[model samples]
Target chain A: MDRFMSLDRRALLAGLAATGVAAGAAALAPRALARTEPGTVLARAIPSSGELVPAVGLGTWITFNVGEDAEARDACVEVVQAFFEGGGRMIDSSPMYGSSQAVIGHALGRLGAAAPFSADKVWISSGSRGPAQIEESRRLWGVSRFDLLQVHNLLSWEEHLETLFAMKAEGRLRYVGITTSEGRRHAEFERIMRAQPLDFVQVTYNPVDREVEERILPLARERGMGVIVNRPFQQGALLRRIGRRPLPPWAAEIGCQSWAQLSLKFILGHETVTCAIPATTSVAHVRENLAAARGALPDAVMRRRIADLFGTL
Target chain B: MSEWWTYALSDFLLFSPRTYYRLFALHNAALWPAHLLALALGLAGVWMLVRPASWHGRALAAGLAAHWLWVAWTFLLVRYATINWGAGYIAAGFVAEAVLLLVLGALGNRIPPATGPGWTGQGGTDMGWPRALGIGLVLFALLLQPLAGPLAGRALAEAELFGMAPDPTVTATLGVLVAAKRIRWEMLAIPLLWCAISGATLWAMEAPDAVLMPAVGVLSLSAALARSFGGRRGTAAG
Candidate 1:
């Protein structure tokens, strides 16, 4: 944690070199400025309660499954600490991702009252098993209740959603949603989005995979459900696919330093997106991701431009 | 069920290669000096394979049984299960294999020693291609398999040794089974399954040496089948 603090301080001192430069300055010192000036991450309103959450939250899919290795576990702690310091609140995990929920619990235990917006999922096939799984997730997270709980991959979703809705009604859970990824079962997902009174919907959305842009995003907007974008980097495949390719010059206009930030900015640029959860293992990456939420999201033209350029790449 | 077909092998791999190797590193560190004992047992297995005496074969089976149980507990159940949710199932398989090996060893003298075409058996005669392949495999598992980590850009500390880690242990067991005059289907079942499982796992991690494990399984199983059928043909000719 202290290592990241010094990194921020070092970036801050670098940013202080160029003063009073208004327009092009953000592009010049995106990292330095974002590091020095904390609490500037763009916040979006959850359509259900109008409560704001940072547009860029941490996702723990493959990143946080370190599993009992003390050093790797501590490295995860640094990532969560860096996220909290970068003004990130929501941290998402699933019961399907082995040991991730426990690692998050360990981090939360270490960070004691870091005020995270905890989100987890109940992924069992049995409806009767749903409550026990969710309770186990809660125990693993060491939280009294999760801010949001989703039906993972819509496995036995109908039964899980009922339990989630009941939990929400009982004040045991704050919000209820359903998740699907890799664009699997979108028709079923959209059907549930229309049928259920869901508060949130987590789905895969990146520059390359834009299936949701046509129907799901528009429907989420129509249904007034907050949208959480998962797989913002396609589980790092997108970034690896764009390997070492220079960022487009227009990226600076949106305060994007790396392809990761550009990919995140593209997702968050959409009006319907409440948050984009990009999972990472590095604290520098967490800080860089949080920086994407800070300033100047791409407009409609810029977003199409990004999508077009990504297709070419 | 049709939806399940859409899923790829990589989707189920929840941990990274780095984390996977580090698990071994940590496991090896915690179980210091036991690696030497595993190596000694591996050498003993090789001796039994080459000698082909009834007592030696029985002792080898008991040694392998003990190794399977130890690996099932220490590595699979305690260590690998941390990252892989399916590891407990694999551990159960290992335990079952251990029990079968124990049964085979306990009923030693009742089962006749091999006298077929390639049978080195109590005669202590020259082992044909099957036993030769078996000895090569056991030696590779004992001496060469550990270096795979270092060769594949992993730390030497993370080296998976025979009898200690599942991959090399299974590989060595297949070697011993293939070397024997007769292949017991019950004893061969679990190690072969583990080979397929381990191969898929390493493939998902994009490890370059992923093919090596399953290749060992296929090669050994093929040799065993050839020897078994060839022995029947030799008997008919005689």
Candidate 2:
């Protein structure tokens, strides 16, 4: 009876948050219902476990790796807070990014008891480092277990993959996967995907760098694997190139108020993409990215249209 | 993975040009006017190169040692380390280089670099052009490299200085050191390597001046090597 009462109260609060988000969306685009409950409106389904997660997540590569600076740390705190308040869950990070894991934990600690979909990576060289690194990641995130554990950049993957699979079986991690960036080592990445039973795979794909679209995306779709797209803004190069160009008249037709939303929505329009992790230092940019996850996703035609428009820019 | 391989410098960086320049800006703003003083010292060292005395080489080395130390503390330690973890160790390299230069400078007339260019069987002819080039380089470090910010769309307030910033500091030092009468091949190792590393980093970021960096490093290295040893002296004017 007590559990039931708590669930009801949580639902009520989520409904309020959803209403607020809906009202905010009204200012920007046509009203389309998001495929989620009140707060988790733009969530996507993970193919392996059928677990739902938000379609837009945060990446901590360079944006969140500001070391030991108080002003930067406080600003990151605000970004993380705004991310959660807008229904984001998957906060992806790696130890390669110095100080990002700690900052995420620092931010997570501030919002006690919120169920965050913790997805982290095992980023260490060979030897008995696999387990120790995983333990360190857990300690850093202040969580007992990670929802997803990927082998970062396929470094020592044969050894690390075995360790990750063992941990998943042992219930230390909920999912096991491998990742690579910029389509580098793609042949090897493809071979691993074919051989290993990975639950998730991260690849760098954006409107500009579409090499992954040829094989990797289709392969993930065929293999029932969840895909995470990194470098959605090409590490801010694409946006910087676009500068402050006016958004197209047709952008409102697809519910994109900002170019960030347009770019992310193009990535999400594909059926295989589970999420896109676009890292940003600005809290306002975080809101813009989260909004991309909601409302409308384009069909194949609309997706190509986005490509053409982006190309001309 | 089928085969394990060592990663290159480009592998680690998913770099952005905007962010890279902003790093320079942050560094420049943090350590203002130190660049100016480094420039002044650098000019004096260059002038010494053009007209050398018995103790001028030691004075030049002392000046370079101080500039290298400043770069180690300000740019690498405080600024670059914030973004790149490898910078901390790289700072140690700069410190080591400074100590070596300082010790070499203090040891008095023993160092080979002390005997100004024409001494010890070195063919110092064609020095007119190289000397002119050397003067330009030293002044560039002091006067022009900071001003180069505007060309790159960077503001004057965020201008990186000669003594404080690594590139101009190293470039300017090479400008003078390479012109020193009897060149020292051993002393150029660390600075050249730093130039190469920083060049590769900028290349990975696709910065506009990426080509110029290693070009200068290689050219300076070649010029220094050519004049350092194994050449017969010419009767041409110094």
Candidate 3:
């Protein structure tokens, strides 16, 4: 009994020492648990709830479409790693994008505990059963409950939103939302927002495409729903429009190094925006994009400068 | 000419008129240097291959291969960029051009000599009207396939090219026929086989609305022709 007690005591002491060392290391290097490096700017509360999220997020529409191959897998891993390293948290993907959700799932699996996940959309417009579509989306993402489950492009929003709402009630989803880009179904989107109690609304709002600013953003704010900006670069069209024009002198003040940053900053500056998801295939581009979330945002004057800069185009 | 040159330069330098201006202004200036370095390396490779007793044929083949690879990379980049932005037609054009260049380069080396078709000299004149027309038609069909749909007005426009929408089967079939006539029968089989494999793979992958039957038929015909031709040539030699 004495020998057994001694051995147990020794084992307990060793376990405690090891745990102490691990805790010390974790305290010293917080990045060990971090999905992404915290940017210079702090996260904002999602007005309705005190949920803090990094202002910059990654979109996997184009970049994350790794077509079920090893090379694509590696590229996605690099992109996800860069996003996580650069303080990006929210990763938006969809079924509309080819194998994007699968790639994101693969990256997350590779990332293990370090993966920073957000939400994705279910784009089942073929009149399939809504519950089946949701189940399939859950399976594709490999998550029992999604951070947010959105109806892509407001397609069968009524049916999907009902399912999402029920899931939310059952604590399967933290938030329920609707998404519509390209300003295609604004009237329907507005009607849904007015009628439903949604936590988020995804829309396209960039400097070049200011159509969303007129109604969608204000409506989102009024409804107390977090607005996720999509196509903040107008799918590279805004960058093309601002072609070859040197960044105005004042752009440096807002930490706008590339037009990508400038464009993202413009979207981030909006008080209504919860996060802007810009798609990029390059790791360098991901780093550049994450930088937009850092430092002081452009005030009203700088916003004018941005507007004027692109106005010349 | 000046306008055309300016547009071409802008397209090449800027990647596109839209992207050129943004990167130009944002001080994201690494692309120019990278492009210059790539161009220098490409030129140096070409020069080295062209040097005396440098295995000109192998060098040419290597250069063509390298060019096609580069084009494919750029094609993917452009397609990825443009597709997300709702500029599908522009993306299709870029990809089609890449495919056209690859096909032309592959076939260019295999054309029989112009000296009465049997002399077996180096080859035909570098550029010929028939070959140019065939290439143009193929490129046009490739580019236009993305614009049409199965539900579109034209029957030929409903064919699949490179697994994009609006199946370009009829036009692609016609193009293959033209290619077979213009190029050697033996050489034509390779492209047919490639198309068949690619189409079959796409079909098997459950890609929507892709027709692989024509491509399979073409490959079978090519294989049959190859076998029969080989038998005849062997008997004659004996």
Candidate 4:
């Protein structure tokens, strides 16, 4: 808590200014305090290290695959800027997302600021090639070391995990884990999670995709693993589906202005979920996603209500 | 158990339609005025299709070969490769096609003899259904294909032209191959493969025109195969 509370307030203030967070707002405190403070970005601890990371991180899937387009690259830089301004720290990406890792590196280089939690994955079919790919990923991000590294989709998990575990032991990597998305290979994923000493595990879990809630989340909790939730909006498909319907009146109590916030709140409401990474291209959307980590989170009863409502929709 | 089968086409698509279209818009902007020249060259190819001169076949193949090489370097390698990992392989295909065209049509003069009357009805040949289909496809690739993007609500700037983009280039090449005196089955290979790839890409992006390229590919391949076998049977009977 002492380390988490020692966030650079001056930097946070500058970021808020850059993101146009009105200084005069009642909840805009000068220092990091309680999570309920409207301007306060919520931070959760990784079970292994207890290093606090912002509850909502940015995802770079289809959103950041802009290639060498200068205009799109600038827009991505701006999105990252806004994400930081909105009190975001973790920015998650994978090599499978074309050009996304390079784009993230470009954005970071342009920003010339240190990313708080730089999370990445090694996603190759060949175990022998994992080190080269990881080196390439690091080169693309321009980071000396990554905060977290996961085996993507459980591809060559045994070999990759051995390398990652060795790297973690050498203090080259902060955390090592495995990931799967869209509810794929749960049995295999669970097997790895149960056997390996993992620091984090990323899985697809949202109101609409709750297969993880059945076993994976519980297992992560039991094994003291940090949980990262992906596909919170089903890659924007969920919001589009439920965007037509009006938000429930009860949603205002939890400070959710949109369905996106409500969805993030439900996912984060899970005790095991350390962070929810939602990919977005728009600055306003990134800010909005980070804001879900602020103010009030949905309670268990509200989570149930949200799930039930989405089930019918 | 291998997990490859668990993946869907959508899983392989790494970028969105907006990003994909914007690539072309930027490509067109970066290489301005080249599109006009390419379009003019495409127009020349169309004219060759209608005129049916003996030299027109060689000229058309050489022109298409140049366009293929240009698109491979400018669009595929320089532009599309940044966003798509598989684009390098696709560009290699274009290069192979260009090389084939240079060897078979331009330098070697290996285009098969006209099986029927020329489009202008001058050559002593029989105008057949396959030739008509070929002419129709050429016109489509030249005139109508560019409109698909704009019609599907994409901006005019993002329109993919024949010489500048791969889709129309391959489509036009297939049409010319099919419309030739006889179908050169060997030359049809890459273009037909490109059609399937293009169609699959669009389908993965959930684009409305997903079926367009594949449908064109299936139609042209079926026509060329049927014509080739029928021609052999006719010669055998005679």
What is candidate 4's lDDT per residue for B1-238, written digit by digit as tens?
Answer: 3577877888788898999999999988988898778878877777777666667778888998999999999999999999888899999999999999989888765553244443334333553666667778878887889888999889999988888888888888888887776677778999999999999999988888888899889889877876787754422110
- The lDDT values for all models are 0.81, 0.73, 0.55, 0.82
TM-scores of all models? Answer: 0.90, 0.79, 0.55, 0.90
- DockQ for all candidate structures vs. native: 0.64, 0.24, 0.03, 0.64
Give the number of the best model, judged by DockQ.
1
lDDT of 2 by residue, B51-94 (tens): 65667767877778888888898778877776677888999998
Model 1 chain A lDDT-worst window of ten: A1-10
Candidate number that wins on TM-score, 2 or 4: 4
lDDT of 3: 0.55
Residue B172, model 2: Cα distance from true site in angstroms: 2.8
Error (Å) of candidate 4 at residue B127 is 3.9
Cα misplacement distance, residue A95 of candidate 1 (Å): 1.2
Per-residue alpha-carbon lDDT of model 3 for A1-313, expressed as tens digits?
0000111223323423464443333234332121222344334335444355666788876556544345557877888888877656788987667567777878888887654546888777644476676677678767666788788888777777878788889887778889977677788889999999998899988777778888888888788888888988866768877788788777888778988898888877776777889988789999998777776677667776786677677
Candidate 4 residue lDDT tens string, A109-224: 99996565889999999999999999999999999999899999898999999999999999999899888988889999999999999999999999989999899999998998
Q: If the candidates were sorted by their TM-score against the true structure, best first, what order would they fall in?
A: 4, 1, 2, 3
TM-score of model 2's chain A, to 2 decimals? 0.87
Q: Give the higher-DockQ candidate: 1 or 4.
A: 1
TM-score for the A-chain in each candidate structure: 0.88, 0.87, 0.84, 0.89
Q: Best to worst by lDDT, what's the order? A: 4, 1, 2, 3
Per-residue lDDT value at A142 in model 2: 90
Off by over 4 Å in 1: A1-39, B108-121, B124-127, B234-238
